[model samples]
Target: MSLFDDYHPLKGKMFQILKPDGTLHPNMKPLLSDQEIFNLYQKMVFIRLADQKALMLQRQGRMGTYAPIWGQEACQVGSGSVLQKGDWVFPAFRELGASLMMGVPLKTVYLYWMGNEEGSRAPNGINMMPVSIPVGTHPLHAVGTAWAAKLKGDKIVTISYFGDGATSKGDFHEAMNLAGVFKVPTIFFCQNNQFAISVPRKIQTASETIAQKAVAYGVDGIQVDGNDLFAVYAVTKEAVAKARSGGGATLIEGVTYRFGPHTTADDPTKYRREEDIEPWKALDPMVRLRFFLKGRGLWSDEVEKQVTEEAQQEIDQVVKEAEAVPTPSVEDIFKYVYAEMTPQLKEQMEYLKGTL
Candidate 1:
């Protein structure tokens, strides 16, 4: 039997640390300390509140269409927290939690969603790419960067975040193949939220699991309970260490779920039944983490109240700062496309300027 037979990446058996009831498995305890776990829990709660606040902002016309990271907090926060300062992160649109953990300001995130281009700019020295709206394309950028880092003898790992639907794209397959062959230090983090917009995972591909696809490229892959913060953190830490040690790339399939619509513009009720969401709700990452902390006497009603109030204050300030920025001019849209505008673009810019 293959060595991986017992693990069965194709079986949909997720590697979990915390059970649905917020209890840890006897043999699967995380390496994190009480303080570390408490800090992680605080970050998760903050991200969840920020996500909800973004939704409310959208409804109130304070923001453009927003992508909700309502249910994938653990996957993003755990993986993001494992990275060092030198590592690079390439995020898909829904990675607000990860970006926030990576030092992307809440105000910047809000500005991006509120249709400001400056929000896309990462602070100097922070190794994050602008959010990629195109599915699966940024993995190539990550792989290329990883390859360059490897060539330069830099011990840096690059992580690319995408949804399960991205696995079906040719760009994803090509990036995986190239990374595997070149032994590039890249981590392909796929949050398998069970749906690609309206299409369920069943229709996205024939592969039993997204992680299993890595086998074809001769790269290591694993499926973890995306809702289990400990599991996500453990697997991601292992992947980053291996990458730093020249073990090539890893594909991590985080089996997660999106509790809300794909975006503010897309309605889940049109395609999914309400019953399908209940089971996932019971396995909420924040709730399970909260339970673990409460059981350990590390959490209390007062702590909850304090954290909630602090998070609200922070998010309120972010919104205020984001809204205070002056609106972009019509000409601003034409500015970032090129260093020097092509004749055709210049003509178009001139025409638009005259119209304005």
Candidate 2:
């Protein structure tokens, strides 16, 4: 069957459970048990708090430019929860929560924002790559990894995270094309936050939706409610399973909103209207999940306080630890790029050493 075959009746519509009004959609049954749902909620809350703290750290000049993952907690946690220890995650710059879910240390995430190269290295056996900041380039790395896994008969899936803006890049097409041709077990997750820096998504591409582009590449294309944690989790879980079962690749376009500035260096007030953000706040993913949990009798006021406190304490500790890491030495920059330094690189390294 073609990846975009007629088997998936819910292709364009996708599957979503929790709604904006904090109620679960009747048609969408909970694939996870109540305990799992509650756990997801707690994880989302923790990740959100960590993201906020990172932003504050950036503003305080303790870290380099940071990307706030506010309003997209569900998108990260839901999708990230699907991976096993063996599956690999290739992340773009904004996926801190996803990285944490995939076994990256929270301190390392903070250390990354603090400009330490060591922070980029995932723990041994974590199967994650350093954050790729140059747009859609990392998808190719994901494809390569998936191809290698396929060759070894490992059945390990590789998921690449990028933004909607990345969909417009040549690398996105190349990676998608190669994955489709090779039938690699890969997932191209495009977080359609509707903006590429200052450019609104309307101008990003003429394509109606990023998922639709998958049809051309012979991949199962899907569009999910990015803010709905349950929906994101369900779709990603299915995609990962499909990949593992040799169903080839899938492209998931998560339609979500960005509530804050793109980064510390960005000023959204200059380009976007204030009203553009107001409606999305009403659709806040965290609030929806919290409401759902409350309806299920899994959340209480006391629990809220306890969880918030826990999240805050963890964030505080990560901040302190990340800040404590020593700054990279002048020579450290010249060390990692190549195994055997070229003559020009050696000369430049000597010059940097003399300057230091």
Candidate 3:
């Protein structure tokens, strides 16, 4: 049976294959080759370190406030790794790992948080959109892109990454409605990390499961164990395939938690407790996945040491490259607002330059 059918939202099912201890489920199998699993594991480790580095950069006053995807690596990598060439990803601001998985350079990711507009440009042929910082708005853009692609007869699927907070926004609902009516090939991937900044998930909506919200839009939906790499991979891969084959949209709620503060500007301790996060520490996506790999003889302490050192070296270089880029010119601030700058904007730009 398909993942969606097997774990229907109303059935209140949450799909999972790997237990917190790295043990596999009796009947379910991972949808990855041994080599593929190892590759993804490496990617996850790199991302985890990169995430910590971003936090450090922010704390050191080198970068601006940043969102930490500390504990959501599986949700990002598993879903991103499955997309084929030509598929597009629309990321909310927190999707640093997912963007990298989708082929965005680590330098660009750093540049974005470093306040460079040049960072907005993804490489040609990689259709990832610029980060949408506004809460819950990019779902509409994703659906629109998907609709346009469908109209143009392009065989590409589009996926949008959002948090649980996004579900409370009107854009999410509107996008779901449109995707359903038109049967556009898109995936609404909600990384439901249990909080929208300081607000808990329960306060955002009364819905028992975010996936069940898909029922209102007449689309397929499922809740998966966001920490389980195998489960996330299985669900996302199936959803992508279904959408690619003209099966319309699917809403996937990956139930996970963020082990850090929501962003550099926010503190979780003010609202939640260490006790709350203690349990999830055991369920860390990295820990279980690492355990699974070690059991298969694909990973070891030496391997981890090497990977971490290599990741640190690579990320350190990316930081240098990002910082080396020239700062934006004064004109850059006023030039992109319109095809031609208005006299008012021109006057403001000139006034600012005069002051500088």
Candidate 4:
């Protein structure tokens, strides 16, 4: 039998309640009430503003390098806001906004970009890892964490966030196999933003869709409109609950776009076309949320001004805090390598201190 044939049929129902034009589908109307919708809109706006501020800081040489989350606000805020405090999150390099939603301090995130090691340290109760830059490797950690949680009989789930390119990696497949065999409480979320750096999605994989890959490991998978905040929130909510309840794993493919260059150092114009991006801008996550809010008389120019100013002030404060942190010492390099430093590492540390 075909892999998909054995998996649950999607039946064209991916649980999206909001549309790009700000209209709600009947199926989604009952899932979230008006107040909840307004709250979602507020969170999306806050993340978008913070993201833009981060880019500005990078350009001004205040940040080492910044990854813009401009277009993927819905995907981050939607999935992130749903996470409970005790749940573990394994994030790739691109999940800054999501991290913030999971109670990662905005200043720590900024400090990370400013080359501070403390930025990687999660708070006491947060089960989040330092951002993973190595493509597709963190999912294995997510699987292992989930296995631990399951063995301890904890009602916790480990959600690992990665991009479409990650799915092509051997680590990703191995992680999936392990999760399936052990019934690990893990959720694999793939933000398919259509490009893995300069390579298009088509060039990244031969599969019909990234979601279909879930079938190989006996898991449920779904594709959602990443730009639609409601869709992302609802689908991820279900996935998280299922994992915590011992329903095994899920692979959610959030189809979104990167509206900016991969990083401040790269030029996207060399790879993607302007014509392709123009239309997608109209379907911007923030704009759609604004439209929805206005329809319900929850949006106003006064509120916009107030929110923008508040976000700016908060970002500015975080930037200052990040800048105030001291640089790492020579001992720092050797100290965290293990519980106890090896003689070779101790000698190297002494040599570095003398060279300085």
Candidate 5:
């Protein structure tokens, strides 16, 4: 049987392959070579460093407001590793790591946070969409992409990365239903980080788990240990394979946590308790992966030091690249909104110019 069927959300089984201490069940082990695992683990370290650098840049007035993916690296990296060249990713604002995994240049990600519209443009042959800022609207966009691919007889799968808070929005449900009805190649990936800005998950929904919501849409749902890299990769691999083979969409609840605030503009301390964060820290995805690699004699303190140093150097270069970009003109904003600027947009642009 498939992993999705074996650990359905209704069955109260949160799919887990690796324990927090770096042990894994042989039966559930994913097919990854030691070198590949090491490379992926290095990527996770680089992601964390890059995320921390973004936070620092925002604090120091070097960049604009940014969302820090402090505790959710594995969710992105694990699933991202399973993606093929033709697959597409529609991400919410907080997918810097996943974007990197999907072949988006770190320079491009930095440029986007640096407020350049040019940053939204993905590289040639990379089917990634522009990052969606609206809370929960892009899942529908993923479904639409999947539906189009289905119609064209394309074998690619489309996945949407969102948060638990998004599930409360109508757009998420609409996307889920449409994907289900059409039997499109879509993966609804929800990173349930336990908070919707200041509001907690309990107030967001009455459902026991977000994965169970898939039942209403006639799709498979599986709650997963999002921090367990092996489990996330295994489950996503299965879902992507199923979708590519003409199976319908699946809703994957990556049960993870956010160590940082929702975004740089918000203060998490005002709403969350310090004690509540302690337990989640133990499940630090990178640390466990490091442990696993070390156990296999692939990683050591020296290797970590070298990897971190290389990542920081790359981040420094990217930050410089983003900063070197020429500032956009005032007219550039209104010009890029549509193919031909609407009368209303033109008027608004004129008004803004007059005020300036």
Candidate 6:
């Protein structure tokens, strides 16, 4: 018998419920009700608008550099929709949709990009860490938090979100290994958007799939079509259930695409061809979901108009609030970096203050 005789046949296949043409797989219908699906659609539209508004703000010099989540809304919203109130989320910088779903206000997200420390603060009783700009480091933090929760007999599970590039980091491997060994209730959610900035996914790893990395760590892994909201929701819901039931850890690789430049500072056209992106445009998650809803009579132009108008108004208010907040002092940056200021830091702060 071959060494792979017992291997899972579906390991490399992308789990998909909604097909790209807006039809559902006959046997893989989503468990969500019509109203629930509508609600999810509304949330997706809201975040897409917010994301576009942020990009515009950055261009207008109203905000600092931003990472746009244009094409990956379903990946974030679908997975994030499954979280319970008490669960924790650790997000890399691109997870604005996930943060928003977890009760981080629009104004706070805007405030964060505008360089305010207050934007990082999660509301009381909300379990979300500030955005981790250092790539793969937060997975370790998520694992640690989950391990602590396990030790304390708390039922909460933690989910860590990172990009395709993060999988190459030592911290990612260490966290995965530790989480598996300890059997902590953690979900390692990787949104494989095909590029780590200008670097393509194929060059990022020699492995056939990012999800298969879980095999070495002895954790369960699944690959989902991140553009299919139904598939993303189903996989994440199953993972969350398993974690709560002491099933150790799981890794989910969401195969999606980023439709914009990596960030405000980067130009994607130099690295990616227009023809390469044209195919993914046909697979846009929002368009697919809208078609599904329309076929079921749950969506229409009027509904789309209403949702768009409402979201734009809400975003307008959030932009106003964010801009009204005063710019953070230079000391604000140094203050949040330490629990109690070290002597060296104190001296540096004094010198900086003197210079000001």
- Quantify all predictions' global Cα lDDT against the true fold: 0.91, 0.87, 0.92, 0.84, 0.91, 0.91
What TM-score number comes out for model 6? 0.95
Q: Mind giving the per-residue lDDT tens digits that candidate 2 earns over 241-274?
A: 8999998999988889988899999999999998
Q: Which stretches of candidate 3 lie over 4 Å from their true place?
A: none
TM-score of each: 0.96, 0.95, 0.98, 0.92, 0.97, 0.95
Candidate 2 stretches greater than 4 Å from native: 1-14, 353-356
Judged by lDDT relative to the true structure, which candidate is superior, 4 or 5?
5
lDDT digits (tens) for residues 118-139 of candidate 6: 9889889889999999989999
TM-score of 5: 0.97
TM-score quality measure for candidate 3: 0.98
Q: What lDDT tens digits, residue by residue, belong to model 3 across residues 1-356?
A: 77788899999989999988777988887989889999999999999999999999999999998999999999999999999889899999889888998899999889889888878889898888999999889989889999999999998999999999999999999999999999999999999999998899998899999999999999999999999999999999899889888999999999999998989999789999999999999999999988898889988999999999999999999888888999888888899999999999999999999998
> Candidate 4 — which residues are off by over 4 angstroms?
1-15, 343-356
Question: Which pairs clash in the backbone of model 3?
Answer: none
- lDDT tens digits, residue span 1-356, model 5: 88777887889889888888887866767578888888889899899999999999999988888988889999999999999999999999999988999999988888788787878988999988988999999999999999999999999999999999999999999999999899999999999999888889989999999999999989999999999888899899999999999998999999999999999999999998999999999999988888788889988999989999999999899888788889887898889769999999999999999998
> Of 2 and 4, which scores higher on TM-score?
2
- Point to the candidate with the largest lDDT: 3
Residue-level lDDT for 216 in candidate 4: 84
Candidate 6 displacement at residue 33 in angstroms: 0.6
Candidate 6 CA-lDDT value: 0.91
- By summed lDDT, the worst window of 10 consecutive residues in model 1 runs over 1-10
Query: Which pairs clash inside model 2?
Result: none
TM-score of 1: 0.96
Candidate 6 error regions (>4 Å):
1-10, 339-343, 350-356
Please state the error at residue 331 of candidate 3 in Å: 2.3
